[model samples]
Target chain A: MSNAIDRGKIEALKSMLLSLHKGESIEELKRKFKDVLETISPVEIPLVEQELVREGVSISEILRLCDLHVELIRDTLRSSLLMDVPKGHPVSLISRENEHIAKLAEALNVYAGALSKASSGEAESHLKAISNILAELRKSRLHYRKIQMLIFPYLERRGITAIPRVLWGREDQVIVKLRELSTLVEKELTHPKEYPNIAEKAMEVSREISDLIFREERILLPAVWILLSEGEWVAIHEAAKDIGYLIPIDVEWASRAKLLLPYEVNGVVTREQVESLPQEFKFAALATLAPDTYEVRSEEDLEFETGFLSKDEVEAIFRHLPIEVTYADVNDRVTFFSQSIFRKGFARTKTIIGRRLGYCHPPRLEHFVKSNVDDLKAGKS
Target chain B: MSNAIDRGKIEALKSMLLSLHKGESIEELKRKFKDVLETISPVEIPLVEQELVREGVSISEILRLCDLHVELIRDTLRSSLLMDVPKGHPVSLISRENEHIAKLAEALNVYAGALSKASSGEAESHLKAISNILAELRKSRLHYRKIQMLIFPYLERRGITAIPRVLWGREDQVIVKLRELSTLVEKELTHPKEYPNIAEKAMEVSREISDLIFREERILLPAVWILLSEGEWVAIHEAAKDIGYLIPIDVEWASRAKLLLPYEVNGVVTREQVESLPQEFKFAALATLAPDTYEVRSEEDLEFETGFLSKDEVEAIFRHLPIEVTYADVNDRVTFFSQSIFRKGFARTKTIIGRRLGYCHPPRLEHFVKSNVDDLKAGKS
Candidate 1:
C-alpha cells in the first residue's frame, strides 16, 4: 500500500516539475506542490527528482524548481521535515553555526545596500564596516573546515561518498573566493579607484555566500540527519570544540539544555548542582565515545632529563609558542606538531595525524608528494 | 673520604694545567694526571676543569690539554672511567651507532684519497663514488637529528644546558654543509671546473663529521654516563627504537648481554629460563621511568570515521606514505606526526610531541611564523 502511494507521488512530482518548466504561473505551481508535498517522504524526494531528470528536465532547471519547492513547502518543513535536536548534538551545533553565518550575511547585505546608493557618501566608514563584517564572515572557513575534516571524513568512512567529493571541492572554492574578496576589499579601502573592481567581486561573493547557505540547509543537513548516529554526532562535537566556534560559546545556554535538565515541578536547583552537573555529564558522554582519538593517558607526569610536567602544562606551552613546529620521523610518519595559539599556520586534525600523506592530497597530486619524499630521502633534492 | 680526595685532585688539576700551559712534557703531565685520576670521578671532571680555568688557564688551552690528557690516559681510561652498559641500553646503542658512523667516515676518507690523487681520467667514476658516499653520509642527518630531538633535550632537562645549546647549532651547521657539499659535488659532475670548490667543501664536511664523533664519544658520553640513571637509558633506548638506528640493529648482540649474565659456574641458561625471567624483570626496570612520555595507550585500535584500526595498522600505514603528516591541536600543542617510509623529513619525539611550538625555535625569527599565521587566518594572504 505504501509502495503504491509513493509511486503516485513520484508521478505527481514529475508533472508538477514539467509544468513549472513550461512557465506555469507561480500560484498554480504552489497549489500543485503543496498537495503533492503532503504525500512525499524525504526518501521519495530524491527518487522523484531522479525520475524528473530522466524525463528530460535539466539539473539546472530542477535546481530552480527546488528553490521554488522550498518556498511552497517552507512552512510545512518547519513543522515536519526539519528535525529539532537537543543541544550538544552535531546537527544542533551545525544549525547554530548556520544561524550565525546568516546573521553575518545579513550584515554584509545591509552594508552593500548603503554602498549601492549613489549618495550614501560615507565611503570610508562604509568600507570599514564592509571589511569588518567580511572579516567576521571569513571565520566561516573554520566551520567549513570542521565539515571537511571532522564530518566529511566520517561520512566517507560510512560510504557516503558523493558529498565529500562534490561539496568538499565546492567548499574549498568558497573559502578561496572569500579570501580573494577580502583582499580585494582591503585594496579598495586604500585606493578609491579600485572600488568598482572590488565591488564586482564583493557582489559575486555575496551571491555565492547566499547560495552556500541555501545548499547547506536544503541539501546538506537533510542528508546528514539520517546518516549520522547519535554517537557519531557526539564525536564530531568533541572534535569541533578544539576547532572552536566563530563566536564565544555560551556556557549558560549549554548548561541549561533540555535533555539534561532535571525533572522538577517548580523546584529550584542548587548552585553546586547547576555548576558541576553539566561538565560532569559532558565528560561522561565523551568517555562513552570511541577510544581511539580520546585515548586518555594513564600516567600523570612526563619524565624528561630536567624534570617532569603535567600534560596540561606541556599543551599550554605548545599553544603559547610563536613558531609552529612539526616532526615527521625517519619512517616519514608525522608524529607531532606544535599548534600555535597566535595564528593558525595550517589546517590539521586528529584524522590527518595518522592518514597516509599520499591519500591526504587529491589523487592527481599524490605522485608529487611521493616523488618529493623519495628525492628528499635519496638526497637528490 | 671521597670529598677530601676530590679536594686534593682539584688542587692537582689546577697545578698540572698551569704546568701544561707553560710547556710541560707529556711524561710530566701524565704522571700528575695518573695520581689525580684516582680521586676524580666523571662528575668531578667539570669542577677540576673549572679550577684550571680560574687559575689562569685559557679555555682553549685547557681544551687542547684535555685532548692530550685523554691520549695519555687512553688505556687506563677504558678500565677506570669508561663505564660499561647493558646490551640494549641507550649508551650501547650510541656506541654501535658511533661504530657505524666511523665505518662510513673511513670509506669516505678512502674514496677521497683516490679521487684526490691526480686523476682526471675517471671523473665520471669518481663523481659517482663521491656522490654515493656523500649520499650515504647525508643519512647521518638522521643520526644528528636524533641527537637533537632525543639526546640534547634530555641533556638540557638534566641541566647540562651549555653543550646541547652549542652542539645543537653546530650539528645543524654540519647537516647544512653536507647539503651544500652534495650540491657542489653534483655541479662538479656536470662541470669539471667545480672540483676545487667541491673538494674544499668535502674536506670541511669530513673534518666536521670526525670531530662530531670525537666530541660525542669523549665529552658527551661521560657527561651522560654520570647524569642519567639506568632506567633513563632504557627509556631513551625505547624512544630510540621508534626513531631508529642509523644502521640495521643487530638483535643478536642486543640479546647477548654480559652484565645481566649470572656469575654461573659452567652452566648455560635455557631459552625458557632466559625468556620468562628477563621479560618479567625488564618490566620492573621500566616501571621506574618517569611516566609522561612513556604513557602507552592500552587500547589496540584507533576509531576513525570509516571503521576501527589497530594502532599498529595506523603506524604502518603512516610509515608507508609518501607525505609526512603532523597535527598540532587547537591549543597549539605538538600532538602527533606520521613518520613516513620514503625519506626522513623531520625529527620528533614523544617529549617534543607535547612541547610548546614557541620553545622549539629561536626567538629572533619568531615573528615571521607568527605574522604568516596571522595573515593566513585573517585571509589577508
Candidate 2:
C-alpha cells in the first residue's frame, strides 16, 4: 500500500515539475505547491529535497518546498496521529513528545468548549493546565537549538542542508511565541478575570508547536532518509545520545534499535554474510602469489616438474649431481629440500614449505643464497 | 680479393644447386663434379654439409661433395702458386709446402732423378731430415688430437658444433696418412733397393698434407669466422698456447697475426670488451638496469610499474628518483642506482649505486632487510 502511494506521488511530482516554466511567478509556484501537497504523500517531502540537491538545485528552493510540506502534514495530523507512531516503536520518544503536545491541544479545545458553554470555573482549570504544558514545552527550546546549530551543519556537509534549516527556523519561531504566551499566562493566572485571554494565547502556542512537530516528522525525518547513508545515520544516532531525548526508553529495545540501524546501507553483502566469513579469509583473497616458483628436482633423474616438485625428487637429484639447485618461491617459501645420499641424512619438505627460505639455512648462509638467487634471476650473475 | 671470389662462387653455387635433380646417380654426380667444384668455394663445404643435414640429404652425397671440395682446393692452390716463391709473403707457408711437394713430384718425373734422389749420398741426408720432420709433425698431430677430442666438444656444447668437427676430421685423416708414409720410409731406409716405392709413397703423403693446409686456410679458417664469436675465438687462441701450434712460427709474426684477427665479428665484442666494462656492466644493458631498479622499490612498486607504467617511463622515473636504486639487472648485475643528495655525511650514491643492495648493508642486517621487504610487499604484515 505504501509502495503504491509512493509510485503515485512520483508520477504526480514528475508531471508537476515538467509543467514548471523558466520564469515561474510566485503565484504559479504557490499553485504548484498546493497541487504537490494535494497529490504527494508527506513522507516523500525529504526525498524530493534530496533529489533537488542531487540535481544541483538551490538550497533555498528546497527550504520553501519544506514550508509547504509542513502545512500538509499539520492538516493531515489534525484529525489523527501520524501513521508512523506505534506502541514501544524505536522512534517512540518522538511519538511521546507529540502525544504531550496533542494532550495540550485537547486541553485548550476543552477550555474553549467550556467557555462557549458558559462554565467559567472549568475553563479556569483548563487554562491553568495549558499554562503548565507551555512551561514544560519552553524547556525543550534549548534542545531544539542544539539540533539547529550543531547537528544541521553536519547534515549540511552531507548535502541535507535545506530541510533542517527550514524546519529548525519554524521550531525557533514556535518557541519564541510559546515563551511570550507563557509570560502572558503568568500575568493572567495571577488575575483570574483574564483566564479566557490566557487560554486563547496558550492555544495559539500549542498549535504552532503542533505544526513544528508535523514538519519534523514529514520533512526532517524523510530528508535524513534521503541524505544519509546507513553508516552516517548510525553516527548521527550515536551523537544524538548525549543530548537527551524528550521521552525515555527501555535499554534493551534501544540497544536492539541501534543494531538494526543499517550500519552499511550501501554495502554489497548483507550483515549475515559479513558475520559468517572467517576473519582470517576476509582479506586473504586479495594477496598475490610469491614472485618465483619453488622448483625441486632429483639429481638422479633430470625428469622433474617445474613447479611444486616433491622433496624426494629434490633429494635424489642433488645427491648425484655435480651442481646444486636451491629455490625459493615468489613468496620466498622454502618448499623444497635436497639431501645428499652420501651424507646419509634426510631433508623434509613439510618442515620448510610454509617457512621462509632464510630460516631454512644458517643465518650466515641465508644472505648469500638470497643475494645469489636475486642476482641470478635478475640476470646479474 | 677473397670477398669478391666468395661472392662470385656463391652465385655460381646457387645455380648449380638449383639445377641438381633429386636421387641423381653417382656416375651422373661425378659427371657434374667438375662444375660443382668450380662453383663451390672451399670455405662453403662445411656449410653445405650442414645444409644437407638440415635438408635430410644423404651422408654419402655430403661425403662425395667433401671429396670434390678437397680436390678443388688442391687444384686451385697448385695453379695459383705455380710461379710464385715470394719469401716471407703472407701465403709463403703454403707456397713453400707446395714447392717441396712439387720438387718431389718433379724428381719422380724421370728415372734418374728418382734413383739418384734415393741412392746418392745426398739421398740419405735428405731421408734423415724428412724422418726428423715427420717425427716432429707426428708430435704435433698428438697435440692437435688433444684439442679436437677434448676442447671441440666444449665448443660444440656452446653452440659451435659444425666447423670444429669438419676441421678436426680433415686433420685426423692427414695424420693417419703421414703415419703410414713414415712407416714406409722406415722400411725403405732398411732396404735401399725399395727406395723408389718408399719415396713415391712419401711424395703422395706430403702432397695430401700440403693440400690439407690449403683446405684449412681457405675453408677451416672462414668456417671458424662464421661459427665462433670473437670471445670464443680469443679463448681458443688462449687455450692453443698451452697446446702449441703444429707449424714452426716466427713468434713476432704469429703474434702480429693474432692481433690482426677481427675481434668484433657479428657485433659480438671481444674478450677485451667484457674485461673493459666495469665488472658490474659486463653483460647486456638489461642486465645492468634490472637489479638496480629491483633493489630500490619493493615488489609492490615492481607490480605497479610493470602493470601500469610504460616501460620507458618506468626506467626514466626510477633513474630520476633521488635515492640511489640498484637492481640485480636481468643479468643479475648490481647494475642500477640513483644519485643520492647527502654525499659527505650520509650514504653516497657513488658508493652504493652499482653495489649490491644486500652487500651495502652490514652482514647482520642484510637478511632482515630482504625478509622485511619481501614480507611487507607480500602483505604478510
Q: Which candidate gets the maximum lDDT versus the true structure? A: 1
Interface RMSD of each: 21.6, 26.0
- Cα lDDT tens digits, model 1, B15-105, are 7767877888767677767766555644344335544544544444555444443443343333232456556566656655765665455
What range of 10 consecutive residues in model 1 chain B has the weakest lDDT sum?
A: B258-267
Which candidate ranks first by TM-score, i.e. highest?
1
What fraction of the true interface does each of the listed models get right, in terms of native contacts kept? 0.00, 0.00
Regions of model 1 farther than 4 Å from truth: A1-381, B1-80, B113-119, B251-381
Q: Score the docking of each candidate (DockQ).
A: 0.03, 0.01
Task: Give candidate 2 regions above 4 Å deviation.
Answer: A1-92, A112-123, A142-151, A251-381, B1-381
Per-residue lDDT tens digits for candidate 1, residues A180-292, read 87887787778765554554565566656656665666666655554445555555665567567775555422332222100011122234423333332223323332211
Question: After aligning candidate 1 to the native by TM-score, how far in Å is the CA of A180 from where it should be?
Answer: 28
